[model samples]
Every structure is written in structure tokens, then in C-alpha cells.
Target: MPDPEEPDVVSATDLETPPGLEPPPTAVRDLLAPDRRFVSARRNLGSFAKTGDAARLRRGIAQYVRTGYGGAGTMSRRLGSVSRTARSLSQVLDPGAADRGLDRALLQGNSVAEITDAVVEAACSSDGTLDAEASRESIRNALSDLLGLYSDVDLLRLTDAQREFVIESFVAHDVYRRFALDVGKHLVDNAPTATIGLSRLKQARNYIRQTIAESFRLLREAGQSMTTAHVRSTVANALTNSLVVFEGYLA
Candidate 1:
């Protein structure tokens, strides 16, 4: 979990973080006053990262729940063209989306989720905090899937990756929205230990990463086009299937 617990007057270099990941500037802080949740979460993150005591992580989660974890990170959004730009894409809606059962079968595929997510994410964003690097990740994921699953397809034409960006951004946003939301829950649910919690957190993040990537692979094999209704319906359907997958894993 990220916490903006640093000094209010840090340098320009202070915000630099590793590529392909959301920066640590997630939690809101006052100019002169430290946020209580951020201060506590920072302490917990530092402690768990250092000592491997899952109790610290667990306690932090409880604190977050008590403090109201709502506006602290990314938010969930509708799956269709969630932005004004999405409307522009609608001009190109595939005429065959209804005819070919693309919306029916591929709704469970990766492409629909990727495309709808790509658009709807804008609607979900509260302000202009969109990350530039999200597209790079989705594109890579989309391209890799093309190489693995649909090698004969033209790379330039295949574009579930934009959808990939939407979902990736969604995940990144969700994590910060609620500190320690799921990172330590599994470990603490069974037993509280930071080492186990850290490991569980890794597994959870990996699950998210793999699921979205696997989901992106099915978006192409044709020039991409779909109605806004198709977009919403397919993505919604894809999300349901994803939940089933997630539930199976959790079970």
C-alpha cells in the first residue's frame, strides 16, 4: 500500500518511482498537516517492509477501514465508452458485432473488457490523474498475446491493448483507493504475519496481472469494431466471467 507520508516540502526528485507502477503519491495530505491515516499507514508499510510482521499490515487495514478508505485510490467504473473520447470511437462501431455473436462469445474474451475498460475508465476517473504509462503496459500485453495466440494477425490492427490499459489503470487505481484493502486480508484472515502477508500480497497482485493479460488476448483477429451497446454488454459480461474465475481461485 502507498502512503504520502513524506514531508510536505520534498524535492522534485522525491516523487520519482519505478516505471510501470503507480507512484507513491496516492494518499492525500495537507500542506502543513499530516493525514492520520497516511501517517499510520506509512508506519505500517515501513514496519512490514522491514520486519515482516503481518500484524502491522493487519492493524493498518483495520485502521484504514475505520478511517474510511473510499476516496484514497482508484475507483471502479462502467465498462462502456466511459469517456467523451469513447464516443468518438463509437463512429467506428462494428456492424458485425451483433451478427457474428462477437458480443456473445467474446464477451467472455479479453478484447471486449480491454476496449470497454479503455473507454469507461475515463468516466470513472474523478479528475485528471491519468497515468501516461498505462497505455504502454496494455500495448505490451496486447502485443505479447498476439505473438502467443494469434501470430498470423497483423500487429498494428490488433488493439485489445488499449482496453488493457483501462483495466490495468483500474487495478492500479483500486489498490490505492483503499489502503491495505486486500494486500493482507488473506494472511490476516488465517493468521497475522508480515512475511506471509507480503507473499500473499504478491500472489494477489500477480493474479490481477495475469487475469487482465489473459483477458486481452481475445480482442483481435479482425479489425476491431463494436457498438457502444456491444462495448457495454460485452465488457459487463466479461467482468462476470472474471468474477467467477476469481471466485474459483478464492474457493
Candidate 2:
């Protein structure tokens, strides 16, 4: 027979031994077996680059857990596990995540709840720390995504790949995303009424909204936890600060 340590049911929360209880790490390991890990990675990617109007990140994760894992039952169970883990982490809400989702809602047209839910999920799951390798990859990814979004050259410089890479790599991922989100939200919330044309106003709104959305998505997908508000305030206080080295790149 199998060793007594192996249990019939493997779960993230089931961290006890057979007949009694297993430990969480063992359960997480069993659940994250190579094949399961592959599935999780794939589902995560699906959450990132879907074609349809952006859906709530929370909904996407929940659905992935539900169907991709076991079902609604599994989602509830995993949620319980995640909730417990969340209690241990610091609780700074990133306004950028909220603004990014809100901007997306205004543009691609999702509900406020859907947008807010996604923002909350992003904020909660954010880790904000990327080592050298991941940071390099993130910089490349950020630039590519930005180029695709901007498609124009005047508003923000697109060259200086090396400088941009350095800025992105050295900066705190969550903090940068937070600031970008803040800038975007503030612009949207305080768009000048004196603007001449509807076209100008719409363009400005789209630009700010898209910028925040892209930054928020990048930050969340990278697993950084810094909120948009934090980043914004930090940058505003001292534009040359280490928290947002991007401004340094501009200089």
C-alpha cells in the first residue's frame, strides 16, 4: 500500500496527514505538481492576453480555479486558503489598480464592479519584487506593450531601449505601477473643462486611461503589490527618487 503520509485527497488547505490533517505546503506541492503547474501557467497567460473586452481579473482567476482546477467547490476552498495567506501580507491598496480598471471600464466598457474587482485582485496579489532576470524581461515586455498602445511618437519618447531597460529594471515594480496609475487617474479625474474640442478631450482621456490600464496590468501580472496611489505620491514628492527611476531616465 502507499505510504501512510499520502492522502486520498490532495488540497492546498489540507496540510495535515492522512485521517487527521496534512500541512499546507505539502498540499500546495501536490496541487502544484508539474502538470498542474503547466495548467496554472497557461491559465495565467489566458488571464493576461484575452481578445475580448478586458474582463475582471478576479473573475478570470476564479473561473480558472473553478473549471481549470475542479469547480466552484474548489474555488471556494482555494479562496479560503488565499484569504488566510492574505491576512499575513501588508494592506496597502494601490489606487493605480483601481484607476486602471476604472479607465478600462470607461474605454472598453466593463462594469464598475467588474473593474474594481479586478483591481482589488491585482492589488492583493501584487508582489512588486522582480529579480534581475525577471526585471529585464519585464522591461522588454513593458516597452513592447507601450509601443503597441501609443503607436505615435510625440507624447512619450520611444527610443533609448537601454535607458528604458535600466529604468524598469532598477525601479521597484509595484511602486512604478502605482505612480503611473496615479498619474493616469488624476488626469482622468481632473481633465480640464476648458479643452477646445471633444476630440482632444477624448484623446487625452484614452491616453491616460490606457497608460494606467497597461501599467496596472503589467504590475499585477508581475506579482507586485504596491498600489497606484503610493507610486504616484512617491514620484510627485521627488521625481528623481529611486522609487520611480523612470523619471531619471527621462532626465
Candidate 3:
């Protein structure tokens, strides 16, 4: 069995709903809406990490294959495609449903050590099969890419407290409650100015940064005194590039 405490690398397969919640049209529209898109993707990535069901993975794979081939390319290009789908799903589903499913899937029957082991295994794999070096590179490169995919709105909404809460929950609860909370709050706020695109972009970037920072921090800290080289470097590069592409959205 995998070590109980290790973090698991959530795969695309984790996002599918069981029989009943067959995605309503309203939900789908919310997911596809420009303002909601970033939030949607954030929720979806959290959902995907928890469930790991094949159907969800299929949707992600279809998206991945369609947008860009994964095996070879700049890491950003690959993660950008996958991240978009994650955002869409996050936007479409009820945040409650996503949270519940994720919590159930992750906390089912493992110690923290086990979870950590699973994460290490997943990181080393390519397409769910083990390949240590590939997995590491895939993880680092893809995450760097994924974080880069966020937009200005994404950065604007996330507060430091929210980020800390997300990291805590992922460790204790195995669910990204912050994502759901953010989306729920977003929906309830009902700001007319927030377009689906902007909303989604905002949500997506928040998840990307929080997840990347948390994971990188944990891994870097696990065995030795941590260094900021990779983490800061990655974030800095992403911020720089994002500024180039997302200047219009920035106020």
C-alpha cells in the first residue's frame, strides 16, 4: 500500500460525477461563462484530484489531445490545455457536490503517510504509469506551466488567509474547500461586472498559484533545508510572462 501521509497527485480521472448529477444546462453555462471560467477550472482541478474516476479523466484526455499533444511540447502549453478543462468543470458543478466528492475520495482510508506515498508515485508517472524522472519533470514543468496559465483577475481575488486555509485543508481533509468556498462566494456576490471569462480566469489562477506553491513548498522542505530557487524562480517567470499576456485585465 502507498504510504499514508504522502500527497497524491490528482489525475484527470478524478473529476467524474456518479449517475445522478448529469450536469444541468444552467451549470454548464456557468462553467462556460467567461467570468466564471477561472473559478470553474479551480473547482474542477480540486474535484479531479479527489475522485480519480476514469470518466473524468477521459474528458480531460479529450481536452488535452484536442488542445495540444502532451508527450512533447513546452510544459506551459500542455498544462494550459488541461487547466482550462479543470476551470470549466469547477464552474459548472455545484461547489457543494464537488467538495463532498473530493472529501470522500481522499479521506476514505489512508494515513497521511500513505497519501504522501501516492503523491510521490503519481508525480513519477506519465499517464498514470511509473517513470520517476519523467514524473518529476512532468510535475515541475507542468505545474510551472499551470500556474502561468492564470490571469490578472485570478491574482486580484486571492487573499493570503485563503491560501493558507487551502493548504491546511488539502493536508487535513484532502479536499480543496477554498476553491468551493471561493466559487460559492463568487456566485453569491453576483457582480454584474464579472464576466464568465474574467471570473473563471480569476478562479483558475488562484488555484494554480496556491496548489503550485503549496506542493513545491512541501516537496522542497520534506528532506532538507528548503531553497527558494525553484519556487520563486517558477513564480517569478510566470508572473513576468503573465504580465505580458494579461496586462489588459490588470488594473
Candidate 4:
């Protein structure tokens, strides 16, 4: 008997071809022998990570430090050059430091750009002794670490439509929220023109939707599942970082 959880396999002969598309004859045979692994796997989204937000952030930070610092000698040397206040790199590279620097910035309601800058700076050099190249590398490593955490999820179980839906809803909510906030601020400021042009608003909406769709496609290609919490957090970060563009719709 077929598994109750599995979707019914439809024969290609019974499938109606959409307008303007002609499927090859082999398509029917291939459909009859679909990949069993994918067919049997759960199709719904699951939690991206089992840990809480703080723990997830700390794990990401620790991974970044370990991967970026290379060795204890290098870390020590970097720390020594960066600061005289601390005797060890652990003082700044550990989870406590992540809590103090990145977490603190987040809790203080800093923008995503500010938080990202702060986290990268704190990771690169606690006392700010890193040169431009080193700082840039640190920022790259920091973002990689954070994005890597979410990219670890298995996305093969989800259908393309499901992934698209999650991404679209996430982007829509973020755009709507920012648009509402900007309009409210304009009203409060008594601006000469409180209304944004419809064309500009449409452009902004299209840009955000395209961005979100492309981001989701890349993540899906990388085998990352789009969980509800992960989608929300990712969209929030995007909105926070793109506040200027989002607010530009008002102009």
C-alpha cells in the first residue's frame, strides 16, 4: 500500500499540459518513477534550529571566531595588537563577548546595518586596531557565519510553491510595515507631501519582491529550508538594512 503521508503519484498521461508547453514523451515514464527519497520525505517546513535565538547567535559567533582566527597563536597575536586591555582573545571572542557586543546592539534597537557593523568590528578587533582589509574580511566572515546557520537546513522536502509563498509573504509584510511607519512619521512631521507617488510605491514593491524571490531561490538551491521563524528573522534583517531604500518610497 502507498504511504498515507505521501502524495499520490499521477501518471503523466493523466496530467494536463498547460498552454504553450509540450512535454517530451519520456516525461510520463519519468513521472511514474519519481525519486522515492523526495516523495517519502516530509514536505512541510520544520524549525531551522532547535536552539533559542541567543544560543543560535552565540553558536554563529563562536563558529565565526574559530573559522576566522585560524589558530590560537594568530588569535593571540591579533588580540595583542588590537588591545592592551585584554590578555586573551577569549575575552572578546567568546559567547559572553557576543552577548555584550552584538546582542547588546540588537537589544538596544540598533538598525541592522549598525548591528552588523558593530558585530563585525567587535569580531575583527575588540579595541579597533584592524586595518581596512582585515575589517572587510571580518565583515564578510561575520555575515557568512550568520547566513551559514540558516543555510544548514535541508530544503529538498519543500515544494517550490511552498518556498515561494514563504518568501513572498515575508517580503510583503516587511515592506508593508516599513511603508506604514514612514507614512506615519511623515504625517507627524507635517511634511509638504505626505503621499508617495503610486509609481514609486509600485517600483519599491517590485524591487523588494524580486529581491526576496532571488534570495529564496539561492537559499533553496543551497538546500536551505524556509522556516517561519527563519523567514521572519531574515526579512527583518533585510528591512533593517534597507531602511533607506524602503523609506525612499515616500519620496
Candidate 5:
């Protein structure tokens, strides 16, 4: 029989009803409202918009992916000097610190918040400024709301179908947070705007989400076990395919 758990089985109208509680949000546009308190996330919004620096976005996402499946990954391999310094301080002074930091690289079963912390930490610009610790907090909230539905699922040992579902949702959620959380003028063409182009923003967010999700649909089947290395490979594929979506995508 066909694997009932395959992501393809879930239609657009489908809401993931996880056992006891109400269905977790499958359409996250409503939950993506920017946390204006996170000034750094706001800075991230404005900075990434102009530079077309998709790589930085990819790097942040890679951290989240690695965290889910245990990856001290190569995303940091090519970070420019500024980002390198930030990662060193956070990952080194923090992760490798003898006194109070991580004694080893993160392995499987790490918490999802590590995704937000790693992304925010790697993107930090200075030592103690909120610029590094922006008033924003969307990634954590969005991912928590969406992935929380799978609380019973063992992320490290997912079937291919479940793994793909997680990957697609992650890409969509990441893209959604970047845009949906832009409650400021960072993503628009003008200031003094009333709505912040909410319509266009929605169009863009949904479009990217759909695009990345479709990329995973092209796969043949969900046969493999999501081993650590397999998770790494798929995460890399997710990043590459996600970049492809952004290439034709605007804003």
C-alpha cells in the first residue's frame, strides 16, 4: 500500500490534527506578524532585502536544519570575515568554552530553538547590542507553531516522507518569517506607508512557500531512513533547491 504518511497525501485544505488539541497551523501567514521588539530581525529584514544575499539566508537556515538532525556543518565554511567572527565568538567562546559552553558539537535530538539561537547568533553584528539581539522573534514562534504539531514525531529518525514534509515546512516557514515579520518599511519601496504592502507581501510569501514545497514533490518516493548523513544530504538539497526558488522569486 502507498505510505499514508507521505506529504503528498496532505492536500491544501488539510489541517494537521494532532491527536487531542486543535490542528496546528498549516497556513502560517497569520502567525508570522513581525515582533517589532527584535530590532536585529528588523535589521536582517532590511539588510537582506538590498544585498540579494541569499547565501546568508541559506546559512541561517542551514543552522536550523543541522540542529534538527545533528550537524556541525559546513555552512560556516565560507562565511565572510564579519560572519566568521560572529560564529567564532558564539560557537567558540560559547560552544567550545571549557567552563560553561557546549563541550561537543550538537548531535541528534537537539531542541528546535537551537535553530533560532544559532541563526541569530551567527548573524549577530556586535557584542552586546540588540542589533545582534533584535527586537524580533519570528523564526522561533513560527517554527514552534508549525513543527509543534509533530511533537510525537522523532525528527532524527523520520521516514523519507516525514523528512521531506519537515524540510518543505521549514523552508516555507523561514521564508514566511523573513517577509511576514517585516512590520516595518524594510521590505517596501517607501516609508510613511500605511499597510506596508500587505497584499503584495502575502502574495510573495505564499508564492515562495508553494515554490519550495513543490521542489520536494519531484522526488520519486519516501523509502530511505533519515539517518544523520542522510539528513545532512537532504538538508543540503533543501538549501540548494530553496535557492533555486529564490532565484526566480522577488522580494
Candidate 6:
């Protein structure tokens, strides 16, 4: 018989249909809201770019940064950061170049988490006291700058499928980050040996990645349209179930 105190080794069968696995609003909203905002900002930036009105573009960038980056207060600081980044883009106004950049950023398997990580790593000093707020500001600015490169025409021309792919990719990356954080928190709290913690975390990451891919596949196979709510529910259910299994392992 299996040891009662040993952590349960989860399998494909174990992951199916977790009982009473209701998705929590906190997790759902945390993942969904930013994704929606990011998608919306891309669409709006495309619209503004089409007009070729510099003032409108600036205003749109500020609004997008405020909404998509965070919330309402401290608008001036965010706007300034965004504006500075926008100013740094190549002034040649070549829509083709801008389009290529946008494609590389969004469509080439790039994730917001990756961009944020890059910015944070670059911004941090030798000391452990990293200015997290500054890192976020830089990320917002970087995104705004990238969007500023393309004309509205370039952005508007993208097919629906392209936009959907970008949105889904962002959601997937966020899900991965959340799962990593959850596993890290558990390991930290439990004070497991480094080797054990690292091994468990790696396993958890692989499982989460596979679960997310399968969830998307099933949705597509069923002819169901993907939405923030649906993705959130699917991810949250998987994460909750995985955590239960992980806690069992820790026990």
C-alpha cells in the first residue's frame, strides 16, 4: 500500500473532473482582466495609428498604458513614461518595419511575462532591492513604444485569427507565471530541500503547461469560442486540482 503521508503522484486520470472545483473570482479576474486590457489596447492602438494623428496617438497611448498597465491614479507618471518611450522609436514612419516589429513581439511566441522579466532584469541593480514599480513602468513604456511604430493601417489589416492567437498566447503565459508563483510559494513555506523543491517545481510546471495546452485543444475541438472567462475557469480548475495533489505530496 502507498504511504499515507507521501505526496500523491498525480496522473492524467487524476487530473480529470476535480470534485467541487469552483473557480475563484480572485484568480479568474487576476488572469483575465489584464489579458482583455492588453488585447483591447492593441485594437485601439491600431485604430489610432490609422488616423495618423500624433496627438490622438499620444492620448491613446496614455490611456492604454493606464488601463492596460494598472489603474487610474498616478496617470501623469505613466503617461510621461509612455511618451518618452514613444519618442525613442525610429522616426522614419515606415509602416512595414513597424508591422514586422509588432508581429515579432506579439505573434512570434513572445509573452508579456517575458517582456516584463527582461525589463526587470535590466532595471535591477547588484543589490537585492529591485525597484519593482520602475520595472513595471518600463514594461508599459516598452509596449507603448512598440505599438507606436505601426500605422493604424498595418494594425487594422491583421486577420481575426492573428489577433486571437496573440490574445491566447498572453493568457497562456500568465497562467504559467501564476502556476510558477504558486509552486514557489508552497516550496518556500514548506522549507523543502533545494533539490526536492526544484524537482517538484519543475514537475508542476510541466504538468501545468500540458494541462493548459489540452484545455485549449478541447475547446477548439468542441467548436467553442475562447474567451477570458472560459480560459480563466479552465486554468483555475487545473491549478486548484494540481495544488491539492502537490499538498498531498508535501504532506
> Which numbered prediction scores highest in lDDT against the true structure?
5
What tens digits encode model 4's per-residue C-alpha lDDT throughout 187-246? 112222212222222222344444445555555576654343244344333333333232
Instruction: Candidate 5: list runs displaced more than 4 Å.
Output: 1-139, 147-164, 176-193, 220-226, 248-251
- Candidate 3 or 1, higher TM-score: 1
Candidate 1: residue 220 Cα off by (Å)? 19
Candidate 1 local lDDT, 55-155, one digit each (tens)? 55444433343332332121113222222233323322233223221232343335633644443333333333333233233333333443555545432
In order, how many clashes per candidate? Answer: 12, 21, 41, 0, 7, 4
Q: How accurate is candidate 6 locally (lDDT)?
A: 0.35
Which ten-residue region of model 6 has the weakest summed lDDT?
Answer: 85-94
lDDT for 169 in candidate 3 is 24
Better of 1 and 3 by lDDT: 1
Cα error, candidate 5, residue 29 (Å): 24
The C-alpha TM-scores of every prediction are 0.34, 0.20, 0.22, 0.25, 0.37, 0.29
Q: Please provide the root mean square deviation of candidate 2 (C-alpha atoms, Å).
A: 23.8
Local lDDT at 174 for model 4: 36
State the displacement of the C-alpha of residue 46, model 4, in Å, after optimal TM-score superposition. Answer: 43
lDDT of 1: 0.36
Better of 1 and 4 by TM-score: 1
User: How do the residues 112-150 of candidate 2 rate in per-residue lDDT, one tens digit apiece?
Assistant: 334334434432443332222222233333334444555
In lDDT terms, how accurate is model 3? 0.31
Instruction: Give per-residue CA lDDT, model 5, range 1-251, as digits (tens).
Output: 12211112322332232111122244543544444444443444344344434443333233332432233233222112222222233232232223223323453456656644553444333343221222123223333544567776543244544444543454455445533333323443321232322322333344446655655554324553223334434434544555544442222
Question: Could you give candidate 3's per-residue lDDT for residues 1-251 as a string of tens digits?
Answer: 12212223333332232111123334233442333324433333334334433233223222322222222134345334233222222221122323412333554466534433443333233343112222233333333332354322121122433322222222211111222322333331342322322333234334334544454455445642212222223333332333222221222
